[model samples]
Target: MLYFDESGYTGPDLINSKQPYFSLASIRMTDEEIAQIKEEVGYCEWGRELHFKSMYKSYHGQKILDKIFNHPLMDNYHVLPSFAHKRYCIYANIVNILVETMYHFNGINLYEGAKNLILANGLHCFAILHSNKDLVAEFENNFVGMVRKPSIESVANFYRTTDKLRYDVDTREGFFDMLSEIPPTIQYIKEALTHKKFYIDLTIPLFSVSIQEWYNKTKVKENVLFDSSEPFFANIEFMESLRDMEVPETVVGYGKGKHVYPLPVGNMEIAKSHEEFGIQLADVFASALCFALTPRNDKFVKYQDKIKSLPIFQNIKLNIAPSTNDFIEARMKETAEIDPLDFLCEHSDRININKKSNI
Candidate 1:
């Protein structure tokens, strides 16, 4: 069976800087391994769930990381990691196309008074956009000709390999460039999340692509259990839909038998409580994975330094490349390139997230 959890998620607002990436991770383990992990990481007297974030600060937390990483049973667990770089994620592509498309339908009103116009124009009010009119007009006029809602088949084909941007480790210019890449339409919808379904729509494919590879390689029929939460993506219908999904054939990493395989998903549910040891273990693994990859400086360097000494430091199961100089380098080892537009535009065997019905 598989126990899954996520970290660094900030809903549909993929551009949120506080969360650099939306990541999902899973550990495949048997009942015996679960009991062993529980006994190793004992519960507190208050019966609080052993979360990695709060614990990583204390000695006990370091000990927990050590135990999980060094446990003799480590060889028995197979890890699945999937994530999206928030700075220029797949949603950035979709929002870019959507903004360009709005221009054809009189984008001035949509950009300036997007919320009101979206409501008045009889389009889906998925989210609201807030930008200065002059700036939006400049953006539209500059790129409208070069931009079109990419064909459903080739949406993931962006400037990944050749045309890439460079940035200093920590600089104001770098930060601003990342923000400028996001389309105004995405900003509006993310801020006014009146419809929670958009968040669900954006995240499922990230998980699906990763889980598909895990199944393809290991041939494990997964019976998934998610940590108990009321987030839009954790709903019963969404989890069930994961059972039948096919990554596009043209997708980057899903060449043949890679991420394009049968999902043979079994029973799936939100775990009633974190007392379930598998969920807690997954929580720890997910949090630790994020902490290791997150940028480090004055504020987070200490955590990064400490993480280097852990048994899981550079563990093959973690799947992050040592250096991510290019777009393909940034992706998880086994997952396909994240093309949110392609996922949204495919419109086959997926919950439709088209702007018309989405609003």
Candidate 2:
């Protein structure tokens, strides 16, 4: 069976300054192993639900985290984690477009304009620029040079250092930095447009696809148990959709030639708390992942180093697809040479925000 939980979900305000990650994690186990987990939790005196966020700061939480992270059985189970960072989304598409627009207009780099504005006011600068059509008009009027110049370095540098963009010349060094940051950030943005079903709707197929593949190898049909915090519609609709419809062949990575199984959630169950040992452990695992990926909020800033070093965090697997938006994908393809998975792994240990302190 599969037990799962969600973390860092903030609806459509996904790019919010403090919390900018949305992750869904699932842990697959057999019925026999789940019984063992219940026995383990009972030994720890965790008679009721073991909420990861609640237990996280307590002595009990750390002990549990250590237990699950090192468990030989758990190490064997498949842990599927799918997540995305919003700021990187902004950088890969939103900022890239603006940089390309500003770079070639009579040599009056709009990237300089974007940098100066963003440094002073953060990403909200985009709203100001978007609102001010007059700025674009003024630049166009003064243009004395050619348009449509392809300057990938200028765009990468704008994303790399907002402050330095004003004083420093564009260099090849920032190109590597920008490519290193895009992989974990490159999923389809459409998945984030809604708040009600943010976690389940977006991640169900991803989890199911992986689970099906595992079943093919082991000949075990895994059922799913989700923490009850998920919206009722998500629980009901996801199960119904999986049974009634074909998993949409979209950017969600139902890649061709791979054995596609109809993963109905007929066996899916939802519980209100960590009362179920499987759900509880899923909570712990999901929360740990969310903490590692999300931007630092006030509550977590103090524990940054400790959180990163947690054993559960050591070997995380992330799958993020490029934005489905054509414009963004075109720019992303032209701007970076490195692979997305490598880039995300390199930056996985800490938040990728430049203005923030490194964790």
Candidate 3:
């Protein structure tokens, strides 16, 4: 069985400046193995419970983390960590749900390869370059509103927000072209969702990604458990679908870029960390990693390199800013090869957006 936990999650409101990064840590360990971690890490006895916050505040607890991380138990693939930049995640979600819808309308292959990721990163990088913090915030806020409660007004607000963008990226030409194809009705967009087959909350992708990482390493479809209190607790069904996705024998991409499917992972239940030692450990791993990446302030910043460079950290996967530039450069096309990006640029027609149907 595998245990899961999360830290630094600000729920669906990713625009929160409080914590820009969110981490989900996973560990596969038997009761005996868990006991070994406790023994090696000098597990605390005085605290009401063993978790990251209390453990990290004291010297003894910090020392315990070191022991736990370096213990032979973690030497293999037993412990896996993954995180996402909250700010970029919102933009990527916009691309995934909104912009991807736009691409679908223009007859583009939205999920043919790594295009979804590349497109998401495309928006991520463009937002950074646009240099309009207020605008970005407004857009994020609207997206959050839409995801929480989808409606015509929310959809209209989101679409109107995109209309506010005044410029475009030359390298990722037509990246913003989704604006042109954005459906006026929320139903249309929902019906035409690009990856809704297994789509969960924007926050859950890292969770799903972590499962794939474990599956790739162990080739096992195992039962998983999560701290019920986590933000993505509501997406249990979606998690199951990811595990049951109909992936073909053909694999795609290479190395970390590689894509494996049907995830070889399924079944989920929620439990309080107090009842599960592995989840408690996951808490420490997630909290420690998140604090290092985004410390509360200068007062908490120490041993960042040691914390970030732990032997296990080397194998940890990250979901941060986009690798979009390389994708666009590799295309080597004089014109935008993907539709929607090149939609209005070269294939523009005077068709009215509101009149479009079939999502």
Candidate 4:
């Protein structure tokens, strides 16, 4: 099985200064294969669905996350003032729970030192990014007999490689559009994948949970560590715990857009459009997970919390569900309506009521 994923380090510039790396991680395994592996590890089925709607209900009751929103601590902080902030907070927390649950069930902590275990069991892990060479190489050196492949780019262009293959995969336009809005430092991620040598035999699906869903699942309290910030930092912490694991053939994929990459745990399909190009469900799941777990700094952690506390963040959610296309359309509309003559007016408000909305 192949695991791939992507991650995003999104927050105000202030927070990003501390922790700058954002990533995702995904893993792939067949039901039969995972069952055999789980049996060996003394694990069992905990749930059925991976979607937030199903997972939330299975883990906690509806509106269970209201507690987080109603917390007095939330009111003290101005960062997460609206329901949207509450929603984002909940989504991050739910992901943390799922990852932690998986770790405990597997009798392995990807963060605590799973790499050594993986290597002992014969697994290969490879990361594609020019920037992570030092970290990747460090792991390669520690885990003997483990193969590490290096690609000289931040992003891997699986689209170009799999263009010939046919599969029933979701469109990537939303993802790509999200990537375009990021700063130059992040923009290179897409450019890096344009080169072909980095291609791998995998596909990854990245999707974000809706704000309402995020809020519903996150409100519940669990006897788990809560980071009170972007969950990626915690995810990286978990991955770091497995730095010593040796596993055969590990692949990581990053989503270059707005989609919150999907998490895969149960039944899914793997198919090909043509023999030359096709993808398996496992490949996509792995990639998405890897990306989500990428790390950033303390600055990002603080900024994320602050963003979550802001009233504007909440209004943004109600005004328009947060999305790449919605943001772009809104910006384009504003740009088109700007008037030089009105710039000097003290209270000039421009409104284009007839523009097409494409969110």
Name the best candidate (by lDDT): 3
**Cα error of candidate 2 at position 5, Å:** 1.3
lDDT of model 4 at position 15: 18
Candidate 3: pairs in clash: none
What's the CA error at residue 255 for candidate 4, in Å? 24
Measured by TM-score, the strongest candidate is 3
* TM-scores of the candidates in the order shown: 0.57, 0.52, 0.76, 0.19
**How much does candidate 2 score in TM-score?**
0.52
Checking candidate 2 for backbone clashes, the offending pairs are none
Using lDDT, rank the candidates from best to worst: 3, 1, 2, 4
Query: Candidate 1, after superposition: displacement of residue 69 in Å?
Result: 2.4
Task: In candidate 1, list every pair of residues with a backbone clash.
Answer: 124-359, 125-359, 127-189, 128-188, 129-188
Better of 1 and 4 by lDDT: 1
For candidate 3, give the lDDT of residue 45: 54
Which digits, one per residue and each the tens of the lDDT, describe model 2 over residues 249-333?
Answer: 2122112213332443346677765466666767776777677765566765656567677554665434432333443333323
The residue-level lDDT of candidate 4 at 271 comes to 23
Runs of candidate 3 exceeding 4 Å displacement: 44-48, 167-200, 241-262, 318-320, 324-359
lDDT of each: 0.49, 0.47, 0.65, 0.25
RMSD of 1: 12.2
lDDT of 3 by residue, 79-114 (tens): 887787887777677666665666667687565555
Q: Give the Å error, residue 354, model 3.
A: 35
Worst 10-residue stretch by lDDT in candidate 3?
A: 345-354
Model 1 score (lDDT) = 0.49
